[model samples]
Target: MDDTCAGEKSHLFCGFFLNFSLFGTGVVYTLTSATSMRAIQRANCYHRDGHDAPCSVGGDAYYMFLFGLAQAVLLQIPGFHEMAGLSVFAAVMSFFYSFVGVGLGVAKVIANGVIMGSIGGIPMVSTTQKVWRVSQAVGDILFAYPFSLVLLEIELINTHEMRFDQMKDTLKSTPPENKTMKTATRASLVITAFFYLCCGCLGYAAFGDGTPGNLLTGFGFYEPYWLIDLANLCIVLHLLGGYQVYTQPVFGFADRHFAGDAASVEVPVPMLGKRRVSVFRLCFRTAYVAATTALAVWFPYFNQVIGLLGAFTFWPLAIYFPVEMYLTRNKVMPWSKQWVAIHGFSLVCLLISAFASIGSAVGVFGSETS
Candidate 1:
């Protein structure tokens, strides 16, 4: 890779997609938090009233605003590195929720005494509808690549270089940075894939053709009302940290670009260990949260939005860029076996991304029109 050329291109694509991914994630999280909160309320209502009673809950706008308020407050954390504890806490919450979901699925399956779904999946759908559903499912699964999203953040500009350096500084010198990163990526991917499979398969087995987009909030298991409530609460808490994890890089980028002639101003907050924070960070992040909140309220189709964002960004950021970088870095000769193989892989991924994007676009606009 020509250092200058690669650097410039990296800056362009990374900046745009990183911002897009983070903004979309903020919107998704906002909607998800609202859904989870609503689920909690509905769970309580169902438990109180009979299961057959009319326990309908209304708009999610209220919960969205509440989530936005929470984010505005939590957005005060100085930078990405400051969110270590928050990330850990969020991970714990996620594990708890995942476990709860899986457990509920198992219990439901046992209660039913048979796996609910068929090998064919949703038997009555038309061919076109099935194709669209399959494509959206692909996109939804691709949306699970938050691991790549985080790596993209660490691959951006000077701020990311600083982040990279921080990681190096923390790691022991024996295994080397490349090896360590690859290992960690593999491990994270494996663990994430396992959890996804467990939850998805079990949920399908339990609910079959009637499965909802989300296992926890879809009201699949109502008898364990308290457990469902706790699971949704964990989702809310997890998303609270998740929003920061995805957006802090954007915050860092803005702080760098928008640092005009004005001298940096730091205000001391006695509550937060007397840590001084930038006033610009406060204003900018608050506005960012508000914008995302507004978008979430405007277009709140969670699954479609996730599909669009994932399919739209997947190939370029996750596949093509990385492959090109690798080929360039290793000086792979054009049309050589390695080059052809790598490009072939990228081409296949590009096609998949394209298909997914079309499906997701249809879903998004279709929902809007209807």
Candidate 2:
């Protein structure tokens, strides 16, 4: 009887161990596959047409690195253990700050260009195609093309005595006095900024404060499903907005620059050619929608990945670009007091952001592990 019982116990233990191992392996596989898919999607969307190809790769890697860093920082927030709900909120907020501070700053010009193009009406898309095409285009320009240009420009400016301010002044020889264009651009920027701020704050409140996870249990509110859906919708809109801002300009420029063969080839689209819409415009809008949807579905949590990219790339562009342009145009000495102070402050912010991103990424990894 005793011998039989011992054998049965051993069999039970072996079975349990096998099940546990399988579960662990499955979880790791899911996370790995998801991460890779997201990264690849971002790469393709931004690096299409080989524009900003190299920077896209570097930017993607940097985003992944920051994600790891963000994971680390979230682990250390105060009251994290006692307030599970708040911990999530804090985590969300941290992610937003890290990305906006870093990624948004780096891609400001591309972001600006996309915004300009979307508003200015890139040949084919209607105003309604506004959400997807504009947002994605902005994202692409900032992460892929403008980033590469900025890096190259910085190198050139550093080597030569020619200041970045001078370059800006030369570029800005005449102020854009067109009231309509100026008004539209300003309006677009303000609206976009407000939208981003609201979403970021709400996202932080829901996830960081644990409201999203707890809404069902704590307050007798409707299921958290609604909130998640709403969040996703907001993200979708944001993506669309960025697409229009960035992609339209590039498409327009391409059409103009490479007129012969490229021009003859009808912009790719299904039926709308018979309508009054230009073939180029129709193709642009249709392509933008399809691409945006495909990418958003393929990489559902792209906002996080984008935030990570922004963390490294966005900040420099935001603070440095305007100032650099100012200095370059004025032809000031590189060592001037004004130059030192402005660049110094911007550099410090960038450095702190880099560290924070690293910390947050660590926290994310730890959470997944635990």
Instruction: Identify the leading candidate in terms of TM-score.
Output: 1
Alpha carbon RMSD to native, model 2:
25.9
lDDT of 1 at 182: 73
Number of residue pairs clashing in candidate 2, backbone atoms closer than 3 angstroms, sequence gap of 3 or more or interchain = 72
Pairs clashing within candidate 1: none
Clash count of each predicted structure: 0, 72
Badly placed stretches (over 4 Å) of model 1 are 1-7, 152-175, 261-279
| Model 1 Cα lDDT, one tens digit per residue, 1-370 | 2364367867687668767987988999999999999999988998999778778788899999999998887788776666666766888999999999888888989999999989989864588988888888888877887566655333332344456677788654344546656766787688789899999999999999999889999888887788899999999999998898888878888888994543455555446654545667778888999999998898888898899889988887788777777887788999999899999999999899989889988888898888
Query: Candidate 1, overall lDDT?
Result: 0.82
Q: Give the C-alpha miss distance for residue 18 in model 1, angstroms.
A: 2.0
lDDT score, residue 176, model 1? 52
Model 2: runs farther than 4 Å from truth?
1-208, 211-242, 263-299, 356-370
Task: State every prediction's TM-score relative to the real structure.
Answer: 0.89, 0.37
Superposed Cα deviation of residue 288, candidate 1 (Å): 1.0
lDDT of each model, Cα atoms only? Answer: 0.82, 0.37
Worst 10 residues of 1 by lDDT: 152-161
Highest-scoring model, lDDT: 1
Query: How displaced is residue 231 in candidate 2, in Å?
Result: 9.4
